[model samples]
Target: GKAVFDATRPDEVRQFFDGLEPFDHLVLAASGGKGLGPFATLDLADIGSGVDEKIRPQLSCLQAALPTLNRSGSVTFISAVSAQLAAPGVAGIGAINGMLLTVAPILAVELKPLRVNVVAPGVIDTPWWDF
Candidate 1:
């Protein structure tokens, strides 16, 4: 079964996870690329929005899920290949994605016995891009 909640809202994340029984796995697909343009003109607020909209939500979900997450289960975070590329017009996006890529391994070790992994996949046209 699946339950939907707004991960961006810490209150929602806490409530959702607090109500869960033991779960096998979690796949965090939270994503937002608010600033995807040349660094020179990109609004700084967009960068902050990326952290608020994407990074914070995902991190909050995981933190809230910790108690309910099974030790033997895994957590997969979906980042983007922009983090691994030097493509023009992606500085902000890359920085945000890179944060997740950077933390996955550390979390794996920190959350030992419970797997933590990240996938930085190439662009996939999904409804999230409809914005």
Candidate 2:
């Protein structure tokens, strides 16, 4: 089932998933908070947008989808390798991605029986790149 959800409002997300029958799996691959440039000249104000975009939405989606997910089903989150392999110019984005690394284990344990995992892809071929 394809549906657009407002991740900022978790209640709405929960309501959306509540309407759907239990599913075998749920995959969350949305990401935001881009273009932060290097940390030296970074604006501290972007923190809210950064956190709101990635961390909040991801959690909201999980909380909403968990109840409707099959006990033996899996929840796969699409994160980036920058979470652990933070290179230059990625300090900001890396922090956001790192949050997922810390949370997956806790969620796996807390949400027992349901598998929780992450898929951190490296630089991949995409249509957006003209090269």
Candidate 3:
């Protein structure tokens, strides 16, 4: 079932998935954050926003779907290649994406049998860059 819901709102995410039948895989592609700029001048709040906007929503959606998620299935997280690149002015975003990368391997072990993977794509000319 495809429906529009706010992933950031835990309750909404829970409610939406609660109405769905058991599924095979979950792909977390939600994106939001203001983590662009030099580390020294970056707004600390942007880092927090990265956690709030990216990390929290993905984790919350996964948590809410646990009951319906098949153990044999997989969860794929969408992150940015900035996490692995050594480019300047990406520390904030990189750190944020890196956090997900760090947790994925551990979760792969903990989740057991269930596959947990992250895909870090480089810059894409999407409307998101229009800002």
Candidate 4:
């Protein structure tokens, strides 16, 4: 998947995962999950390049695999605590996390028989912050 996606364009996403089968477990994460922002003003190209490019294809792939997913399969999406907590320059992170958190439950409910869950992590000691 790319870095950003146009949620409205399902076809683009679907085409990417046309032949792949579902797995027993799926985990999703994003590099942009961590960052400070006032929500960068982005154009279509930026959206396509930064977000849609990354997430859309992955989601399309997942949606394509949903029907064939294992009966007991589990899908987990990694979000951030920013979904619940607010901070300065975290608007974009919070929005994205919140969207994933909200979508997780819906997916779980709608994709019954297939478990869907989200792991929202808070600040942790990671190599990215070591610098």
Model 4, span 1-131: residue lDDT tens: 44344443677445544545655986765343234455555232433342453345445556765766686988777777877886766665566556667777888888888888888888988874653
Model 4 bad stretches (over 4 Å): 1-22, 33-35, 38-58, 125-131
Q: Which has the higher TM-score value, candidate number 2 or candidate number 3?
A: 3
Candidate 1 lDDT, 3-119, residue by residue in tens: 788888999899999999999899999977587889999887887888888888888899999999999999998888888898899888888888899999999999999999899
Candidate 2's TM-score: 0.85
lDDT of 2 by residue, 1-131 (tens): 47777777778878898998888988887667462468898675665665787778888888887777898999888777777775787677677777888889899999988999987777777642342
Model 2: clashing residue pairs?
A: none
- At residue 104, candidate 2 shows an lDDT of 90
lDDT of each: 0.89, 0.77, 0.89, 0.62
lDDT of 4: 0.62
Q: Which runs of model 1 end up more than 4 angstroms from their true locations?
A: none
TM-score head-to-head 1 vs 2, winner: 1
Considering summed lDDT, which 10 consecutive residues are worst modelled in model 1? 122-131
RMSD (Cα, Å) of model 4: 5.8
TM-score of 1: 0.95
- For model 4 the TM-score comes to 0.64
